[model samples]
Target chain A: MNNQKIAVIDHKCANLHSVIKALEIFKIDVKICTSKTELKDIDGIILPGVGSFDPAMKNLIKQDLVDSIKNLTFSGTPLLGICLGMQLLMENSEEGSLNGIGLINGTAKMIESNEEDIKIPHMGWNNIEINDNNNSRILNGIKNNDYFYFVHSYKCIPTNNSEVAAFTKYGQKICAVIEKNNVFATQFHPEKSGIVGLKIYQNFLSFIEIGK
Target chain B: MIINKGNILLTKRIIPCLDIDKGRVVKGTSFLSLKDAGDPRELSNFYNNQGADELVFLDITASSEHRNIILDVVEKVSSEVFIPLTVGGGIRNLDDIRNLLNSGADKVSINTSAIENPDIIRKSSEEFGSQCIVVAIDAKRNNNSWSVFTHGGRVLTELDAIEWAEKVNSLGAGELLITSMDEDGQQKGYDIDLLKSIQKKVNIPIIASGGAGNLKHMLEALTIGKSDAVLAASIFHYGKYSIKEVKDYLNSENVPIRLI
Candidate 1:
């Protein structure tokens, strides 16, 4: 089946089911590529993640796929990250002493509230206010303040606010979506999200608009 | 408390319980091969515009790393749909309920959190009012007893879901989002037995979830299952039956429903 190949980067510790399911709901072609060997010449790459930052980074390193991912991103190949995938695009993650992919300079830290009563995991559905004034193709099908499903405790705080394409509130203000050229990341899962999340994939598919 | 957006209460709510990961909705058969159901924002717009009464967004993603719903996504959808959205999964405390409501969610549902900290229900109800607190209980038949599963049906808790429903009601929960894990996605129909049992035990409105394939199932849920409302993902997600179609069928079947 030679479909539009979208890889749920098999970086050892990743949630491939929901991402693959989202692509399937859109009827787009998707595959689970656990290794760089299977990700040659793909239409686009979807790097998804869950769980801890240190273990996730360790798994990515153990598989020796980080360099390939960087190469792919540098080559201008379209790539997207969800949740931990989004955090990996940052410069460093304070959750674990590991530096991130550094694709975008940002810091990911725990959700802290001076209110003295906010929970840590900050679970549940919340509204995502779109920030990209340019309204790039990724946000084409979505509108400002459309709620998407989110599940994360720590979130990336982009130092460069310009790179913040979207933002969400969790105790303190946190980065929701980050975009710079071919690289884009959403702290929320478009795959597991409802129709709004599907629109993100549809937009991404349209955003790439080309096969590798 | 009084209601406005949720006041008239939807008679035929085309509610979709989204299975979210990362932050998107995921639907699958038997909890596998999850597909892009659609963007939550776009889908919410379509549903809200499509004459839907309400929306239910479930953060189906496991919170092993303490994941929370993306507020931007919620704000975006709430701003567009202008409809009440009931959000659930990994809700731990009253603060979570406050955050969700502040982020534009109309109602917040609790599962394992209620079990781990039952006091939260009382606290949340007192702070946010019972109307804003929804208790979602996932029960599966086990050796002649129904058991509640938490953490996205990954962990089977010791609490008897049916009894827990009554307990939560006593704890001041306003509603119940009860699902039969055995019937979820099977499409045979809503779990009549499960709903019937819980309906007898709990006084609050019960939104029966799982095992709905067609309108007949919905009618059965209302007439026989005696559910206050019926919720399904597959039948509605695949577009096999539009919300209007289901309502029409339900009406024909003599089930009282809010018709446009």
Candidate 2:
């Protein structure tokens, strides 16, 4: 864990400093990778993002990081996406026109409540309901319904139910954490979720340790 | 610390606002003379340790000499305090929001500028996201209803308080930070009617600001006033009540609160 480096890819749509600061708190060796060349020599990768999907994808294309991320994930590098980054792990999103990385068999859809009372962004602290049989190492040692900070309007709907590592309810049950093979993602901001968020980061570090 | 049960997201936030003048955290009486509270970094760390849900850093110095100092404080606080941070004061344009966000602020609040040009609310929220765009409303009771005030509650705007809140929410403002000018620094309690009026109009989270004298006042803001969170300065700054004490009080009353 000490020697292994985790690259937090900067697609120019994220508050990368907060993620860096969160990683730094646990003494995790982390770097900000803006391009393909910078992605080299990293054991693990964290794709963190904010804002709309179109602009996020545009920035990734502009920085020539689209293929680099795909290649690294294809090569079995442990990849973790946070918030909009997690939404990008799907094939498509209703929030934007451009297609996502298509790493998972899913599409991101808007979170609409049956009742008019539910808010749009689903902002604030929400708990996670872990999938019992997904075998998600990302949620290892975590409780069944531990709360994490979330702020997003769209949610990913996986084609295969097995990919759902965790689900959280806003208006309906939305995919909160998805895990498939080497790739893992969360729809919550672990960096902003306080102690439990740090614990989530620590669990990610443990994955790096197991790989090493 | 988040404790969630079922569909009810039961966590009422307690945010400690650090009013920064120049570089040091300062507090003023009726928005007049100021006195130092402590170093921003040290005070933030203390609050974070005491289980504060979030922190707000307001650059109280209305001058150009100390422009970049708050950014440094925000950067320092963001690194040490692992909670959501909202930065406000003198935020006028997209570049200002970008700079603050780049410096590690989770949210950037716009007050005077948002009222002057409401388009900035749409533009900034589109540029960033609704989650990070906070519109701070300083309202004073004007006859029948509250009126919007700008320039640190000095300049009064013709815009009605309730109308302004609805307008901003429609224009992509994620959250509303409503500060009652009448109740500010009075320490009696939050303007319950003011909070309730805005909360009814907008679906977004409302952070009740201004007066907060005791634990019961905060409870009223969360309960009767229906505010999502409560923001305060003097009560926490002068050691009248610790963050832990407040949380304990709220928790005892069955007001879903996160205790660290």
Candidate 3:
């Protein structure tokens, strides 16, 4: 596990420092990758992002990393997306005009609530209910209805419900975690979610270990 | 388990604020008369361990010479603490926001700069996501209404508190950290009227700060005040209450608190 290298895609969004710091606690080698060459022979890939959809996609396109990510995932490299990174896995998003990475069958839509109490950004700690039948590896030790920190305005809606590993209720059933083949994504920042969130990274590392 | 009748519960946050002076954490009464608290990294780690939803570090150093001191503190603290960290005080432009974010701060709060150049809010939010840009408004009640203050509440601006909140919301700020000057350090309670007025004007989450002396005050700010989060300093800094104790109190009150 110490020798296994994990590449964190830096799309010039907000700081990728926390994500890297979180992974480092597991004693695995982590590298910040901006171009295709940096993705070579990596054991795992982490797509962490913050900010708008169009500019993030544009940053990936400018670095010519769109196809590299798709091809890597096509070959079954475990890829995990966080927040906007999760939204980018969908075909498109209503927040912007650009197309997504198209790794999953879904779209990112704005979370609207008629109830005055429910906020738009959903910025706080919220509990999640794991999909009983999905048997997601990332949520292996995570219990049902455990709280995790979240900060976002948009929610990911997967076309296939089976792909959703977990869901959290805000105003409606919002997709909190998705697992499809080699790709896994979460709508919350695990790095900032404290201990339970660290357990998630631990599970992801175990998944990578099994793959090896 | 505040609303456990088959309803989704997004718990309200309880943030511990540390006002940094020089390098150590400090607390002041209504933004004056500073007193030393503890080390930033140690206190931050303690709060994170005690189940603080988030932490805010306000650099209260008066001189420009010690401005870089907070950045070093942020860098050291962010490496150890995993929860979301927000740093405010002396942020001037996008570069300052970028510098703090790069130094591992999850959010950067701008007060005086946002007033000096309102466009800074829009530009910084556009450059970085609105989620990472927090606009801190220090407001003081003036007779029938409230006015926004800047420079650690030492300078007054003609901007109406509610109007400024609406403007910042439109300008793309993700959250507003409103500190009440009148109730600050008084330990009576938060400015409930001030929070309610701003909450009505903007859809963004508001963090109520100042005048947190007891548990009921914190509950009142979250319930009657309608704030998404409550930021307190002296109570926690002086060891009057623990974050767990406050959360337990709120949880017992059915406030949907996150209990670790």
lDDT by residue (A1-212, candidate 3, tens digit) is: 78889999999974698898899889999989999888898988999988888899999998899999999999989999999999999999999999999999989999987888777778889999999878898998898988998988899999999999999988788899999888999999999999899888888888889999
Q: Rank candidates by TM-score, best first.
A: 3, 2, 1
Residue B112 Cα positional deviation in candidate 1, in Å, after optimal superposition: 0.9
Interface RMSD of 1: 13.6
Please give, for residues A149-195, the per-residue lDDT of candidate 1 as tens digits: 56566889877787788887654667878887888888876754556
Query: What is the per-residue lDDT of model 2 for residues B1-260, given as tens digits with 9 covering 90 to 100?
Result: 12233346537889999999898999886687788899999999899889898999988777887888888988988888778999999987999899899899999889999988899999999888899999999999988799999999899989999999999999999999999999888899999999988888998999999999999999999988988899999999999999999999988887777766
List, residue by residue over A122-155, the lDDT tens digit for candidate 2. Answer: 8887778999889988888777768778888899
The single-chain TM-score for chain B of candidate 3 is 0.97
Clashes of each: 63, 0, 0
Ranking by DockQ: 3, 2, 1
Candidate 2's C-alpha runs over 4 A off are B1-7
Model 2 residue A71 distance off true place after TM-score fit, in angstroms: 2.7
Residue A114 error for model 3, in Å? 3.0
DockQ of 3: 0.76
TM-score for the A chain of candidate 1: 0.92
- Give the candidate order by descending lDDT: 3, 2, 1
| DockQ of all predictions against the true structure, Cα-based | 0.02, 0.63, 0.76
Q: Which 10-residue window of candidate 3 chain B scores lowest in summed lDDT?
A: B1-10
